[model samples]
Target: MDNGIGNWPTIHRVRHPDRIALIDAANGAELTFGQLDARTNALADALARKGIAQGDRVALVTLNSPQMLEVVLAVAKLGGVAVPINCRLQAPEVQYILGDCGARIVFSSPQTAPVVAAAVEGTDVSEIIEIPSGEQRAAGEASQSPYETLIAAGSTERVEADVAADDLAMLMYTSGTTGFPKGAMLTHANHHWNAINNLTAVEGIGPLDISLAAAPLFHIGALGIFSLPLLYVGGTTVVLEAFTPDAWLDAVATHRVSVAFAVPAMWAAIDATPAMGTTDLSSLRYGLCGGAPCPVVLIESLTRRGIRFAEGFGLTETAPIACVLDIEDTVRFAGSVGKPALHVDMMVADPQGEEVSRGEIGELLVRGPNVFIGYWNKPDATAEALRGGWFYTGDLATCDDDGYYRIVDRKKDMIVSGGENVYASEVEQVMHRHPAVGEVAVIGIPDEKWGESVTAVVAVKPGADVAEAELITWTREQIAHFKSPRAVYFVDALPRTATGKILKRDLRKRWSADGSAVQR
Candidate 1:
C-alpha cells in the first residue's frame, strides 16, 4: 500500500465500510465502520465549526470509551492534533500540559470537569466540552458551554480536510524523568507505519477473532501497537473501561476475544483470580506484554495455561515499538525483549557512545521510520535524544549472540512498579513539598512480587523530625497511590555529585550495604 494511502480517515473510508468499528459495553451501544465514519465526520464538522483548524492542539481528558476513539479519528480528519491527557493526572500536572501544549480546546469527561476547569483556567481555551458517560449528566455547566446542547442538536455534516500523510496527528507527552513531561510529535505516517509493523509481527487477525484491548488507548502502546492493528485487519475489538480480572475474563469468554495485549501486573491478577481458573481463556491465543518487564514466574504461569506471551521494549519516542520478541522465538529468547522490528535498526552503545559488543549491556539506540519527528517545543532535548539519526532510548540493555536484547537497567531513575510508571523526579518533587524534607532521591529496588518497588531516601531538615511512614502517607495523599514510595529512608544527607545532582546509584549501594534498615 502507498504511504500516502494510509491516512486513518482514508483507510477507514475505503476499507471495512460495513464492518463493526466500536461497541460501548457501558451503554450497550455499537457503531459500525460506516457509522463510525459518519459520527467522526460529524465530530470533525463540529470541531471545525468551533474554530479548530489544522495544526491546532485539542486536549482530551477522558477514559477508554467509544467517544474517545471517535475524537481521536475526528482530530485526524480535521487535521488537528489530539493530546490525550492521562485521566489520572492531578490539576497542577494537567495545567502544565494544557499550558505547555497551548491547547485551544479541552474535551473532557464529566467526572474530570473540576480539574479540567482548573487546568484551562485563564488560558486561550474558551470551550470545555464535557462528555457524560452512561446515564449520568454532570452538573455546573457554564453559560458558554455548548457541548451538551450542540452534540444533542442535529450535527451539520461538513467536508473533511485533505489531511496529508505527513500531517501531525497526535502529540503524546512522555513520562518525564526530569522536569515536566515533554510532548512527542507523531504524524499520521508514524501511526500508520508502526501499526503496520505491529500487524506483521502477529499471525494475521480475522473477523472471527476478537481482541480485548483493556489497556488505556491514551498510551501509544494500546493505540498504535494494539488497537489500530486490529482495526487494520478488520477484526473485532472488545474495549474495556479498565482492567479487572473478572471483567477481563468475562469479556474474553463473553465476546469470544481471541487476541489481546496486557502488562505483566495484569497477568498476575488474572492468575490469582478464582474467576480465571474456572473461566474459559481458550479463546485467547496470546498477548503482547510490554510497559514493564515480564517476570519469569508470570511467564511460566501463562505458559502453563497454554497461552503464548511475548515481550517488547519501546518508549514514547519510537512510536512505542522498537523491538518485540517473536512468538516463535519465545522459548529461545525467554527473558529477552527480542530483536528490533523489521524496518528498524537497534544497537547497544557504551558511555563513549560506541556500539557495544555482544552480551554487553549499554544504552540502547534505535533508528527507525516509526520514531517521532521531535519533541513538540523542546529543541535541545529533541536534538540530544535524536542525534545522528538514531533515537537514543535512555534504557540499558545487552544483546546476545542470537540478537536477542535483555534489559539490565534503566539509564534514568524511572521506576515501573505494578505496571504504572513512577518517575523518581515526580516522587522527589512531592518530597520537596514537605516542610521536614531537606533533600530526597528515589530509586527502584528489585522486588520478587511487584517487579520493581519505589524506594525513597530522604534527608530531613536538621531540626525537624519526620517518620518514614509519615512521608509515605503524605506522598500517597499528594500523588496517585501507585506512585507513592513503598519505603522511605530517613538519612542525614543524600549522596550528590560535584555539580549537585543526587547520585541514585550511590543511594542504592548504601541500602545494599546497610542491611539493618526500616522496611516502611
Candidate 2:
C-alpha cells in the first residue's frame, strides 16, 4: 500500500501539515508539509495530463530551488524517471544527456532556460516548461512560464500510478572525470532506505533540524545526505540558488542551519572566508564532507569551533551514503570514513570478490537497499559492476584493525611511476598543507622511463603564491620522494564538476594538448 517517497509529504501532512517543509533561501518563500503535498499532487496531475506516464523520462535542467524538488517528487508520483542535468554544463553536454535519455518532457528555470532551450533543440523532448523566477535572475533576461501557471489547474486527488518501491524513480547521471556520463537508476526503495540509513547513521538529526542544500542538488550528496532525510522526518530544507563562501556563511547564521554537507573545496572556501571566525555557527549540530578525500585539517578546524565535522565515503551508485565517521570518533579517527553505515554491508575485497586482509587496500564493495539498481541502458556495464549482487565501488580502500575504513584512491585515478603505485589523493592531501594552495588536483603525465609521472595542477589562493620548486620540495618532505609531483602547473582555478570534484581527466587532456601549461 505504501507508494514510496512520493507519498511522504502526504503522510507528514497528516501528522503536522503546518510544519515548514521547504524554504527558498534566495526569495524567503516557504512551503509547509500540506502545501508541498498538494503542490506535488497537482504538479503530478499536470504532468500526467501532459502525457508523462510510467517509465517515461522527465528531465530537469535547473538550479537549486524549491520548485526543482517539487518537480522531482511530482515525477516520482507518476512513476516517471527524473533525470537531473547539471545546470553548469554547456549546451552540448546538456544535449548529450537529453539525447541519451530520450526525455519526453523537459523542465527549466529562468537562469538555465537558454542552455536548455539550445540543448533540447534536436532531442525527443516534446514540451519544455519554464518555471518562473524573479526579475533579478539571468541578468534581467525575460522568461515565459507555463509550469507554475499550471500547478493550480490540476486536481489535488492522489493520482494513482501503482508506483512501487522497485520502480525506477530517478536516473542520476554520474559526472566522472573521464568518459561520457552514465545514468545510475535509483528506485524509490533506494531513496527510502537512504533516508533511513541517514537517520540511523547520524545521531542527532530529527524533526526540527534545518539542513542547508548548498551543493548542487543534482548530485546525490546534497540530496540523499541530509535533505531527503530531513524531508522524511518532517524537518526543513533551505535551498540555495547557488553556492558562495559568503552566501553559505550568511545562510547558516541567518537561517540557523543545523546540518549541511559540502565537498572539500567548499569547506576550504568557508575556511578562507574572513567571516568564518566571526560567524555564529552555534545552531549547527554537525556537518559532513564528501565527493573527495576530506583533509583532516578541515575536520580539526571545525571541531575546534565546537562544530562537529565528519567525513564519509559514498558514490552515486550507492544512493550515496554508504558510510560515515561517527561524531564521537571524528577527531580520534580523523582520516578514516569510519565503519559502514547502518543497513549497509561493506567490504574491502580483491578482484575475485574475495575479502581481503585488514589494512590491505582493495576495492570497496557495498550492498544495501540504498545501492542503486544498475546503470540505465548499459547492461554490460551494469553486469560488470553489479556482479554477485554487490556493487563494486572502484575505490581502493583499507579496513583498519578497529573496523574503520579509509579510502586510498580511486582505481582509475591511481598512478604508476617507475613500477611504484602513487595515489593522487595522498599527494593532493599533502599538497593541501601548503599555505598558498587554494585547490589542487594530481594526475599522471606520460613518461617513457617511468610509464607515468606524477604531476600536480594547483590554484593558489588570492594574494598567495608558491614557487614550483618550493612546492615540489615541500611535497617531497611530507611524502615519499617518488610519489611527489614531478611537474607543477599553476592556474587561476581548477576545473571542477558541479559537485566540486576536480576534473582530472580534463586537466590531463589540457596539459597534453599544450606543453606550455606545465611549469616543471
Predicted candidate 2 versus true structure: per-residue lDDT over 1-520, tens digit per residue: 5476777898898999999999888766789999999999999999999999988999988888888898998888888899988888889999999999999999887789899989988899998888766333333332235765678788788876788999999999999568899999999999988888888776747899999999988999998888888888899999887899899989899899999999988987898789898999989888888988887777778778777887778899998899988888988987788888889999999989999999998999999999999998899989989989899989999998989998888898899999999988888878987989878889998888999989899889889978999999998999999999998988999888889888888888987655775534
- Candidate 2's displacement at residue 177, Å, is 1.6
**60-120 per-residue lDDT for model 1 (tens digits):** 8876766777777777777889998877678888888888898998988767788898888
Q: Provide the overall lDDT of each model, using Cα atoms, as 2-decimal numbers.
A: 0.73, 0.87
Residue 189, model 2, lDDT: 91
After superposing candidate 1, which stretches have Cα over 4 Å from the reference? 1-10, 134-158, 204-208, 413-520
Q: Give the TM-score of candidate 2.
A: 0.96
Each candidate's number of clashing pairs is 0, 0
After superposition of all CA atoms, the RMSD between model 1 and the true structure is 10.5
* Candidate 2 least-lDDT 10 residues: 135-144
